[model samples]
Target: MKQFKVIGVAALALLLSATMAFAIGAGVGRDGTIVGTKGKAKTVQELIDMYDSTGCIDCHEDAHDDWAASPHARSIYGTGRAAATMITAMKNGFMSWEYSGVKSTKDIKVEHWMGCMKCHLPQLADATDEVAVELADTLNEWYANAKKALKNPDDKKAIAIRDKHQKTLTSLNINCLVCHNRMAITHKWTDGYPQHDTVYGFNDGEHEDETFTKMKRSLIMDESIFCGQCHGMGPNLELENPTQCATAYGSYMWAYRAEGGQESCQECHMEKSGLGHKILSYSDETMQKMAIDFKVESYVSQWLDGSTLKPKAVVKVKMVNRSGHSIPDG
Candidate 1:
């Protein structure tokens, strides 16, 4: 009993010490974490805790595990380089963004979570449930309330809650719900994303959605409009061919836009023939070696040869998986 009591006391002391150490936004991580605001948000560990606390773990426990092992999670968390730089900027007065001269590698200290859609969670717009309507109405109400507060800055009662709501930002991120959920393809005539699933298999026509009265969607896989939302190479998710690039989905089609193969962004980017959500970071080495064993396409006989005569035609069939993903290279 004496030893047990002593152990309990020791544990209690340690717990209290940790609790006391926490400041605003401070939390733990698999490695070092920064805490506090973007300026005061010190350590990389605290940022990781913020990311983990976004409630993504509840749905994507497995993908999160894989993410922890990926180079992305490591680079973001392990390298305190960005965190240190953010601190420097904070001291200089640029509070949130840790500006870096380096283009690709530069990331905000906690700049990601400023929005809800960045995380791979499903967009509420895609919801078929009344929950989206409820949430939207709530946000609208809150927005109105906050707007009123802005008018009367002196009102303390309305300021606090409205301030939190007004400043409520999420880390730009994604979870497996994004990758696993259905996605639409791009089109020249419409916006991308929230597009209809065309080339992507599963629901060839419709998309998988929950029952809802009114909900906004992120990757709505219903029509060409949705895929164009992101696969867009043009302004405002409007579909257009980027001059230097091939197809928006990384296809060899810029040169052949007139061809029927002038496919949309989701045609190549979204899952089809073993494509994953990570998008194409495939090296020639990965895209070079065939991963899949067999071809997964069907050819229409009517389109194959003239129907009039059974003329034996020499057909050159080459099925190459050029995209950096797992495809059955037959």
Candidate 2:
């Protein structure tokens, strides 16, 4: 009887230990993440402030500068084109669709904008529906003012309005927190959720930052899958209305990895290319040179046709994509 009781206690202890382990690894029960702690941002500026990484510049000046030069900095307002496209998608796509639930900019919700913002500004997920509507209206105003400014060229009011909205749109981007914290862990249940006060990187230790005082190691920080989360495969079916963007990661997996190519996105775009935080594509001259190899051969030959000899010019061109994925990928 005593032996049976001992066995029962031992089994109970083991079960409790397993349960505790699972709880710790379950990632704060969903509402304990940084975004959750902060709650949903109500405005565009509030959302920008929620994921602000301006303080990072004090310690990581070089990385900040490099990142500022990258498209990630102005992700939503990419050379003024991205903002226009966002508005176009809202106006043409959401408004035109019968069941999108968005008939106008005011009707826009967080889910409606997720198709674009999912990559451009993942932080948008932490914002309220009102923020989404505000962002849409702001982009529309920016587009209209920009057009007026282009026509007049000297209308300071139009130019000022355009610039003001541009600044707001550009403020919300894939900043340090978005990468090193929010998106640092893909398998949250396995690796544990990214803590609000922890900055994930190559090592786990004490950090000097005020807000993010602890540094934790991210398993996928240097992996291609880290970038793949946003770069994507094909159409994003998760949303009610799917939106297809860049398939570079898809091509990289099937075309490159399937064929035994072993390079990661960071290996080519960051390390070997020496672009570092300024992760560029074909836009930068260095990336352009690294992505492709071209060769041309031309010769003049004499041909005999019946009794007459004719001169013929022949040109041979060869090109190869040396990058990991397709040449013209988004």
Candidate 3:
């Protein structure tokens, strides 16, 4: 994607940070394969392992590559900026007004931060009931496995055990099914454990699986409402007449709609301005180019200066808000 132009001499910078790296540890091998339970589980990590994205690439090779290069994959990876900020908070305590005075991660607990995880660390959001308990228990189990593996470094079983533990500690790799199957994925607490099921709605199209087709349409091809699920929520920071926090959708209804806008969010953000999956923000030079324009003009004085050239320079800046909601809303 190309960048929107700048008004003056400033060349747009395309130096945005790409992604943070997930700090790899014991248990998982060089191939990113986890030696963990392949089915239902008793802990949060176990549940997430059941839906890992490692295999999705085999079937969705192109999309997988596109997404791998996106900020979505990098966002929750241990190396991402958000991950670094959260890691700091996890270690140093809550640093915002929302969780004001919380002393540590243990003090407020991971489950209490559902609002953040629902977007950033969605696997944690997908797991059902007593999530904090599941997280705590899973962490302890992984630690134990790590210890066992360390004690017998050469043992194959020990290595597997260690890898299993490492899988739990690593943030859930951004899985494709989350966005595509958002309408279908269901998690419920059953018998004191969480169970996840995907029931897509299929249509009688050329494809046999109507639900899969519909899921793709709802998320990838047309709809913007799916993006709204997270982006439309409270805590929007772009409100012009500011309040504590408000939904971007509300502001869209108030201002953007009045401008006769009809395009979905994806039309601008994803399809036109981004790589297949590298959903960028306004700060990206490419994004800036798509949304703004500038023109410069100069005029010499009718009466020339006694000894020097005097001229008037005018710069015209045009910012076209094609989006239905305020940019930087999220």
Candidate 4:
């Protein structure tokens, strides 16, 4: 009996075709081993590398690049660390919240409010720079974080962190910029001898590199107002701390190189228009004996009650933001 002849020829042909298709699907092709037919494989890790702690290199590639290792940057962050510790003492309670991830304005807006930008970001009295607006947005974002903390300050976990941060704030680590932006011109802002007429400029700029250092800050090194941008408060205050630097200057232990090796805030926080971030530094012991120093002193008199003539007293003070930032004053 011929078994192959039992089924119809057409049916046999269909069965053979179906068998061939199943065999093709089940087995591997010439590519060796068969994997999922996704796309080509990636070479780099999706997320692995971390940012380097080498100062503001990417943003400040020029003169400030030189300054990245200087004490100015150190003081800038140091002041912040000291401030955080002070806030911890205040016992706002929410302690564990970490702000170390904040690396830029975007980070500040999205993460936490730092004491430096709260004031040092700069607000021009007679000018409005879009850069300032970017800075303002960043600070406002910080305000948003603070407001969030304040609203629910009663939360046990949040309260602990808040109180801890509050302790740092109360320690007077942040100083003027922690509260103010405006400074009085007081008098002639002259450096050396050749007096030039005063010209107002914005506190902010977007120059990726080599900006005001070549033009402005190089010239205005003597004016207290420049230093005031971070330490003075009145109309320019962005945030208020009861422990104001204006009230007690020695708390940060500032040392000055500007006025004969004296310690003051301006000596280190000095910004040349083109120079990038200035990181100031300090210590508590050195700051204790340091007193408020002024470059110029003035007095006011109105003929001792007679309306004949008048004069007002003014003074200039120079300080190193902290120890070892020995860059001198005019």
Quantify all predictions' global Cα lDDT against the true fold: 0.34, 0.89, 0.49, 0.33
TM-scores of the models, in the order given: 0.28, 0.88, 0.55, 0.26
Estimate, for each residue in 1-330, the C-alpha lDDT of model 3 and write its tens digit.
133345222332322211111322222221221211132244565556555555556656887887776666654443434544444444443434454444533444445445455556655544544554455444445555656767877777866865664555454555565564432222212211111222132332233332222221222224555566555656634422222332666666567666777776677777877555667666578877775554455554444579866675555555666556766666
lDDT-based ranking: 2, 3, 1, 4
Q: In model 1, which regions exceed 4 Å deviation? A: 1-54, 65-257, 262-270, 273-275, 284-330
Q: Which has the greatest TM-score?
A: 2
Model 4 per-residue lDDT tens digits across residues 1-330 = 355566677688899867755643433331111111211112111000011122234543664454444433333224345334323422232123353443333332211222333342221211223322343342233334556667876656655554444432222222222111122222223322111111123343333333112112233335444454444442323433222333122223243223455433444344322223333323222232332232555566545547556565666556533333332220
lDDT of 1 by residue, 1-330 (tens): 999999999999999767655532232321121112122213223322333433445544664665544323422112334323223333333223344221222322222211222222223222222332233333344455656677988877676765443332122123322332233222312533222222232333443333111223333453334533333322222112112211232222332243454444345443342333333333323323432233454433433354564434344455654433223210
Q: Give the TM-score of candidate 4.
A: 0.26
Mind giving the per-residue lDDT tens digits that candidate 2 earns over 1-330? 999999999999999967765643444545557865777799999999988999999999999999999999999999998888888888888888998877677888899888898999888988889999999889989999999999999999999999999899889899999999999999987888888898999998999988889999999999999999998898999998898887889989989999999999999899888999999998888888888888999999999999999999999999999888886877
Report each candidate's C-alpha RMSD, comma-separated, in the order given.
23.0, 8.1, 20.0, 23.1
Report how far off residue 51 is in candidate 1 (Å): 7.7
Using lDDT as the measure, name the better of candidate 2 and candidate 4: 2
Poorest 10 consecutive residues of model 2 by lDDT?
23-32
- RMSD (Cα, Å) of model 2: 8.1
- Stretches of candidate 4 exceeding 4 Å from the true structure: 1-66, 74-80, 86-116, 120-219, 233-243, 246-330
